[model samples]
Target: MSFATPLYLCGPLREPRQMLADQQYSGHTSIHDDSMAEKLGFRAGPIEGPTHFSLFVPLLAEIWGQAWFERGCFSSHFQNMVVEGELVRAFVERPAPGTTRVRAWAEKADGTPVLEASASLGPDDGATLLDERMAKLRAPEKLVILSGLYVGMLGAEDEKVRMDAEQHMGDLYPFSLAQKLEGITENSPWYSDAASTPWGRAVIPLEMVSVLAEYTSKQAAFPVKQPVIGLFADQEIRMIDGPLFVGEDYLIRREIVALSESKRTESYWVRSRIYDASGETLKAEMLLNHATLKHSYADYEAEASA
Candidate 1:
């Protein structure tokens, strides 16, 4: 694995003075809700993991220039959860010129780690964050959402979806890229103002990229039996050819990579890669671990037993 340029390195990237204040987006029954989050032993609805990805984009942009957004990839493994209002900053070890991949991490004001990852660009012929993790994953013998499913299940066919700035991104993300820019806590004009950067237009923020890239996952036939609410236990988004443009059409295809479980939930991990409109250029990809609460599926025991 090699890079087009040196790995990006600079001083710590500090987020804006705002916190992730969108807990209200999730309904009262969702774990992200205050009461439910507290009941589940969290300090508060831990701010969404995707929200933290914002801190690293500027560093990527600075390192690779506007081209990074076009083709940069940031793959990560989250290490901890932090609440709103917590002060966290991103740091990357400056790589030597021509380095392909480098270590990156986010830490609290006190230096406690939040997430650790490998950030890069282009076709990473080398094993990736998810690829290495998937290689060691073991599926549970019993599952609720994934009972009928097995690893390596591909989508029925290649699914094509596009990002429309005016439309809400289904239930999971009820806001559009235009709407998300309204309260963007990270505070980068490059995300919404075309004049702010050399990309010729405003770019999509990482948080909104979650919606643009993944909102259609619900339409996928993952073999989950019941309609259960799910949360992202882990996620990684990587861009291959170029930065995805706002409101532009992109293509996506999903595949079930692995399955696992925890004491309270069953998990299904899927990898979705985004391509350019022509479907020839590899643009971006996301690996998501969707963990559904066992209790949410009323017949979880029956399904697991079967």
Candidate 2:
């Protein structure tokens, strides 16, 4: 198991204009938008973290091909990096046979490394990648509970429509990869078309996942303003069985599988699982935490006077 002679991969062949266009159409509500990024103090709308993450595909495919899907694990942190107009590189280092180390960094065309990440890979060995021991080792006191209170009250019981992927398929939005890479770069050879790839050519950028999760969160019986405090901590994409095509309309069914409250921290956590029309879990384990505003004596007096 060794990578071909080249041993290095660069991805997303073309610059992704469609992503920017979609951001515009969606009212520029993306986390990467200049205004939002400005609130976070960034230069222009940052390219989406997930979109940046997706750049890993070319190298993973080159090194492990289809096997990467079956036995790959990725854990990333959304650190202080903004996505502006820049050329990023995906680098891989193979120190020994049966072992491949990978790292990615976003850079200017002039070659300054902006964002950095690394991952190690080996055989599965038929062992559970996500096991109880790993969970305990990760967070020993963490509690996993199932709560249906939110779902029982808010979730839609009846199916509204059977979404057709074809109906939604058409001209890729302005900000989509299809449009972004148009005059800037060529389409990724890794992606067959929006509807044909195992992971689906970057039809929907990764930034939208948080949006979807937020929308799904609001749909819950108890809608509240809460930021994403933490994720699964350790999450792996086992298999992307079906392609989520661009313009394809598909049913999204959600269920609140778990909820918990920490008396020590006075915070609440909720988790929901989403399934596509085919009953295959397209995405799962969305976690959200509650928050409260702090009030000073003057603030309390002002509120009291009001």
Candidate 3:
């Protein structure tokens, strides 16, 4: 809870780029676009939250070593939106000599908090940041944008997904792995040189792993009110038998695990399981909280009043 010093580790300040300015979803420009963000009340398009995950890799890796890539988990709750050109740095609390979990956070140079998180190495069984958040969730008194969604709902199909260096990730992402690497906050040969990594394959960057899982998310068809703006409220990514590799075949299956609401938004929690091409070997998992802004739905008021 406290982020005071002796900071176990701190990353260099970095200006993460806004690669999602051109991103589109639900047949409209997403909140990551400057125009859409302004219309939605944000000063400018904010860089995707996960883009900052790369900044913590070096710091975490230093603590857990190669095991960090194989079985580490990062669970986060977004605290503030960050636009391009803002300087941000990552920090990790120094853990007791044998503790598996530690507090982590990112902050802008001006002292505004960006996110608060928990980082841990496997085989960890303790509560993560999202675990704590999910535990305290109160069911919504009403549902509008996400009325049709419910817990335990499964994806429409088993999606076969893969990330290749040059393969564009579709409208939602609007970029390729190669393009992301060009401006990545951190870099390593393991991301590009197959022969250079201990796994003997090119591994996808931490942030790109988020992109890969979401690349074909639409195909899952967990129907909700359309054209509503949403943003990630909380997230957790766990590497099971990972570092997921580039140019490798993988399959993803999604399920709606929970739904809740706030004064201004309705949220649905989705858990995605990534597996080997055969769908038998579990590789990684991602749990995302997508919070849809109530005002963005054209009929939110009308439906509520009715």
Taking the tens digit of each residue's C-alpha lDDT, what string does model 1 give over 1-306?
A: 866664545445354322223333224345565666676667776666777777887777666666667666677777777776677888776767676676788888888898887777666526667667767876586676777777788877666777666777665565666676665656577766678777676677776677776676655767776655567777878766656777678878888888998888888888888887778877788888888878776787776677
For candidate 3, what is the TM-score? 0.97
State the lDDT of candidate 2 residue by residue for 1-306, as single tens digits.
Answer: 964564445654324332542343222244345575455434666554445545665566577665554344333433344354566554544334466445444444556553454443434423232332233332213322221244333355322222122222112222323433343333354333544556554343222333333443433444322231122222222223332334443344444423333332212333434356555545332333332111211243343355
| Tens digit per residue, CA lDDT, model 3, 1-306 | 875556568988999999998888888998899998898888998899999899999988988889899999999999999999999999998777677889999999998999999999877648899999999999888898888988999999999999999999999998899999999999999999999999999999988889999999999998899889999989899999989999999999999988999998999999999999999999999999999999999999999878
lDDT of 1: 0.71
State which candidate has the highest TM-score.
Answer: 3
Task: Please list the residue runs of candidate 3 whose C-alpha ends up more than 4 Å from where it truly belongs after superposition.
Answer: 1-6
Best by lDDT: 3
Which candidate model has the greater TM-score, 1 or 3?
3
TM-score per model over all chains:
0.82, 0.50, 0.97
Off by over 4 Å in 1: 1-29, 156-160, 195-199, 227-229, 278-280, 301-306
